[model samples]
Target: MGEIYVDGARCQGHARCWALAPETFEIDEEGYGKVIPGRENSGDELNVRKAIRNCPERAILERSDDEAPAKNEEVATS
Candidate 1:
């Protein structure tokens, strides 16, 4: 299985992640993005991919369970 993460440093509150996957992503008070707990693996790979690809900041990422730690400064996961 794969996991989704939101890079806090890279997130610019563009909301592309939330727009593409509302159930998986959310915008915080500061307008930055956060991954909704337990929603990252909602089995909606297509939308997740869309969120990842559409992020202007490239903040959304998908990593396989066995993959090494993500490169983001801060990784938010469900």
Candidate 2:
């Protein structure tokens, strides 16, 4: 599974991510993009990548299995 993170402070409420993958991304009541926890890897990887790339603010980030942090504590800390 992959992980998605959104820097809410950088979000401009453009909602492009939501438009591209509503199932994976949502706008909170405050109008910022909220990457639904645990749902990031449920959708198509290409769709997720496209949505992240289309974000005007570049607030969206994705880490795939191969790119994810190692399970070791030292690796996580680093």
Candidate 3:
């Protein structure tokens, strides 16, 4: 039940997020990775967490429902 967002500035077209969570992320035509529209807040449990940790660019960010309006640092670096 966590929420994920991909930082376009940090994303260098690496599809690691997509590879780790296809159902939650997708690579755009330009090859940059993005969270699938509605799936950004999906319940991936482990895959999405892996995506966040495995992202070489550290582009993928997550915030739990309880952590609103907080910075990415507020969220644990799973």
The best candidate in terms of TM-score: 3
Tens digits of per-residue lDDT, candidate 2, 1-78, equal 456777777899998988988878989887899878778565357777778879999988666667665666567788
Q: How well is each residue in 10-40 modelled by candidate 3, as lDDT tens digits?
A: 9998798888889888998999998888786
Clash count, candidate 1: 0
Question: What TM-score fits each model?
Answer: 0.70, 0.68, 0.72
Which residue runs of candidate 2 sit more than 4 Å off their true CA positions? 42-44, 63-78
Best prediction by lDDT: 3
For all candidates, what are the clash counts?
0, 0, 0
Residue-level lDDT of model 1, residues 8-71, one tens digit each, is 8788888988888887888889888888987756535788778887899987766665563554
Colliding pairs, model 2: none
Question: Which residue pairs collide, candidate 1?
Answer: none
**Best of the two (1, 3) by TM-score:** 3
Kindly indicate the candidate among 1 and 2 with the higher TM-score: 1
